[model samples]
Target: MSSYADLLKTPGVARIIAAQLTARFPNGMLSLAYLLHVERATGSYGAAGLVLAATSVGQAIAGPLTSRWMGRWGMRPVLSLTLVVCVLSMAGIAFLPLEVWGYMAIGFVGGLATPPVQPAVRTIYPKMVTSRQLTPLFSLDASAQEIIWVAAPVVTTFIATQISTVLAIVVAMVFMVGGGAWFIASPEVGRVRIPRSKRAFGVVLRRPPVLLSTVVGFLLIGACAAVEAAVVATFGHGGPESGIVLAIFAIGSLAGGLALGHIPVGPWAMTRRMLIVFIGMAGVVFWLDFWWLSVWLLIAGIGIAPALAVMFAIVSSSVKFSDTAEAYGWVGTGQLIGAALGSAVAGFLIDGYGATGGYLTAAAIALLGVIVSAVFKRAHPDLRGRDASPIPDTEPVPVQPS
Candidate 1:
């Protein structure tokens, strides 16, 4: 496996990664920015929550379609058109004085047009580097994503509170447009086109490994969302302290991803590690003191990126190359759905029983992921430490010349 430094040295890899990161940074900010903006304008958290829900619903609905479009129409055209619509919709939400219905409509449109940057980049990764470098590359990618999650909220909150909520949203929109444009224009993205899959849309998700990964991803992300809500509830909202606590969780994930390169392990080792950490986190939640809670969160956080990296590796190895982008889209949708469920459920629990209920909810969700993994172990050949080869059943589509 190549070291992180060596991976970046691969021609054109670093540029795409940078552009992808910029395009995705807005993801971390969008929900919070919307929440603040709507709540302030309408004086109703209910309205704000509804708008956020619309955005998630829109993204979940649009994700697979967008990925398929990328395959058929090519990255540049799909991304170019979507980026334009996304920026405009975001501007509408920020600047328009319409009622909650208008905000919901605009938010949905923005999410529907959310740039397919992550899936596009992941689809291009195998073409950029040798098979041996994949694990490290994925680990580095996962780790870098933590930085976006850590920093984006801080920046968004500062601008929204210090300057204006409208400006905060505009800033996020600018990054999305600038980054999406640069990514679409990249030489590598322009040179290669993913040949369209002949199978019906969503068929790729029928494969057991892909389905399993999507379900597990949902559970894991849901747990993270619950934990976030609990942490914020622990320290009341609208303070800098909660942000620092969340950053600690991300830092733990970063440390774990970086450490994964040094450990020589079989294919599903990361999954097992994730399960163990989740169990530990559940047990530690009983402590409940601020410092103790933070310690447990940090420990649980260690498993997050590693688990995601391994899931991506498994999905990559399990499906035909043509199915790659759509497979990732399904996984992304699972995550979005999970986060929504987690927050909604955790909010109810916390309101009724306090932070303890939130912790318990997270633990239960993690255990559900474990159960699913165990039951489907046979279905996931890659998880069994089998030879890391692409599934032989499907023929790979060659990259079409532009």
Candidate 2:
């Protein structure tokens, strides 16, 4: 196999991605499914909206709780648990005749049990490839997620149209089971704990780079989620093709992330130039509510994966290998919290002001990321190009010379 394809053969990396693809494939269909069930059973958008809120709550809380499991029992057990929970959740929704409340309950449980794939992918990346090769690899992962998000929904939608939605969900469940079992068989994932006796929360929380990175992730994810909700609401009812603009928006992000992820940059790369990226990325988002929404969004989306990969690489590089799970978990949690906040707020804002309100609100929130990055540069003159994470096993990260 070629070097790029070789990632698929890597024991741990391959399995982790497989599990991610499996566990998350159905996520694309979730919004549509909620709409279908709620409208079908309760005959009102109000009840459907309420159920979607419950799902968001479940997903938001799931990150932290699962983080604890990943910290304690390690990836294998957590991966297993995620698969089981995902499978069971799908089954309940599939086999049972659900009332509106029942649908809400299932959606909540399903969201809560969703796997923390991005963090897992990050923790294993440094191990899967050389330090220098990490960026492109992460970019590929980001790109793959967008591709999956696009494809999965189309596939599920087709199946539901042809056969039944339940059958489509069952297909998603099979992918999870098959992929989860395969991941467990990998050699690299284990429960070995690295030495860190200090409080994990205190040490990680106080670190400045971590704080900055978490803040940026929070703002970016919020903007993305808000856009997602807004697009769904705004372009809704156009036709069967009405919802496709989201796929286009995501494709833009995927393209941008791929460019950023795969192309190698010089050292201290993101520190000096991030502001330009921040402004441009946030600005294009403001008017992304029209026929041209997808095009601008594509431009806006391009900066995301690259910038995010840079921050995540920096975060991983700064922490001890032992704390990778929790550190990434915290960042993930912040992003999730932001997404949750953005989604919740979009409903209120859109209802009051209009669909355009959502676009403006999301952009304004993302601008905070630009402000935070600027403040970081001003306050910390001494902290440039610093990958704070100590290399593991007392073996210095040679490329880093740390």
Candidate 3:
């Protein structure tokens, strides 16, 4: 706790974290918003799933490309442009009276323009604090991000159910505009310049740790996405229980992240954390009652942030400073892909087999993640007693006249 206090006390650390969290808050809201909005409009969860899938595909493509662009073009310009395009797309989804295809098209466009806020903020963390502080910072960031999960669902559900689903999306856009502006205006975003990678694109995937993190992160988030769709489907017609349950789940994640943030990360750390999630989610399949689902999900949520923090630290420790942005980009892309597949598969299953299908999908994805993490224990960097900062890029100095 003292370490976290010190990290927060560092200039611009708290501000940047807060601003970025606020800016990225929409990431939490949009999936559920789209799910409910499209489901109501098109009268099918499968159609809603398609829209979410399209948006995530766009995001998957954008993650690496946009993050790399920040290195060449600068953060403010790239972020500012994406912010405008993304907001407009969100508006289109809310206001445009179009067929399911129209919504899918706009969702894809919106995803392509998804701001690289996660990558940007993460890249800035290395510059903000000491090497020793870096891992804890990652832990803190991961844990804190649960705030988005905690609040976004509750708020989105309330609005979508009580007022209108369209209004829920409008509120998300407002957060995007306000929070994106705040993040862009922050000094650290301007201060930290991501060095252009000398390595060609896609080269970062060659690193074992980066690849391992990307794979495990894909499975982990896919499991999470499945749970989310399941929760909404279970309680979407039952009032605010969906929001409350999801928020409770996020609260559990926040608690776990904060409690486990200072613990040393070993090669098997991710596997251990993922097992916790798998066990909890596996338990969820036995009972579909409201209380039963919430309790199991709360337990599952406890492992989410800790697993994510480990992934972030491992990637940061493995890559060069110049390649960090792109590495994180690939990592983000994996998660988005996971979300897309998880949501789509879960939606289809829910339509056929009911909420049980969604829970089963989540448990299966989580179990797979655990197995992958354990098998690749050799690839997970032992961060204990080691610096977690990005490898400094070596520049070639010109030879002077001898």
Candidate 4:
């Protein structure tokens, strides 16, 4: 499974992975595209930021509910409905000439309608492949996702700058529709329906492993946000160099994720690797030269994807089949909130104390993740080579109408 050929050989795996990636491409592009479009329209960065914030807020609010809906209603119908709403909202943002409030409301609606593609696809993975294939499959999925982060910005920026911002957004909308359609049409997605949980949504989060993973995942992603802010600030805010720095960081993550399946390490080793990288990043706070900063970020990014892969594995193994999507949605929400908080905290610190403050914020957050992991290690028995079995699937599976 180390090679791409072996991974692609899994029946229907390639098709679903392609569908998932295609559906997710816009996720990486939409924020920057929306920001550029709004800024161009309003002639104010502040307005653009507010619109983007609205979008994030909407997404954060909807993520768990959407996941719950997917479990309740099944993937095809829910995804089809959300995708249509998302597309319409994108078109509204592209075509309408709205004030800040208008833009914010539309952006919020767009985000609220954003498809839960990641959680849906991930939840389906275990059912698609054997237990032995799960690790490499997740590793491949994580690594491939880096392509979206790296490519979407380049494509969006080029189109927005060379053509019209409106056109760029339209292009993203086209991709979103096309990808979502492909995913919804896949037979595998249509066939599977996760049993609904008898317990309340809050009960799922009450599980020890779920709770710990959510918190740790939040801090880890928060550290990433801080580092991104610091990198941009390091090169002077809005500098062209910031994009390259981020791309390189993503490349490092891609490399690490590709290597994860080959490594013979316990689950806890993933956390240790993350801690070491964060320490290295914290050490680089003293030396703020651009070249050195880039090198530091690259090194720091090496564990990002692997750590995420580990987190996904842990969450998948720890939760009931019924709770899988919602559990992931909770983790996704943590990452989103953490990112917003990290950027806000880093921005405030950078204003007062320069790039050093941002770097330090990132380090502190990473260390906090380490502390949380250590303290709650018992919750994650998988770290110690023991499976954290799901709460039994006692609920009856609903019959799908043919």
Each prediction's whole-model lDDT (CA): 0.83, 0.65, 0.90, 0.82
Candidate 4 CA-lDDT value: 0.82
TM-score of each: 0.94, 0.81, 0.92, 0.94
- Candidate 4 residues lying further than 4 Å off, grouped into runs, are 1-4, 237-239, 262-267, 383-392, 395-402
lDDT of 1 by residue, 132-158 (tens): 777677778888899899999999999
TM-score of candidate 4 on Cα atoms, chains taken together: 0.94
Residue-level error in angstroms, candidate 1, position 353: 0.5
Q: Evaluate model 2: give its lDDT.
A: 0.65
Candidate 2: tens digits of C-alpha lDDT, residues 260-368: 5544544444443344334544554456545567566666666666657666666666666756666776777788778778887887888887767777767777677
Backbone atom clashes (below 3 Å) for every candidate:
0, 5, 0, 0
lDDT of 3 by residue, 225-332 (tens): 899889888887658787778888888899888888889899989999999999989999998888998899889998999999999999999998878888899999
TM-score head-to-head 3 vs 4, winner: 4
Weakest 10 consecutive residues of candidate 4 by summed lDDT: 383-392
Highest lDDT model number? 3
* Best by the TM-score measure: 1
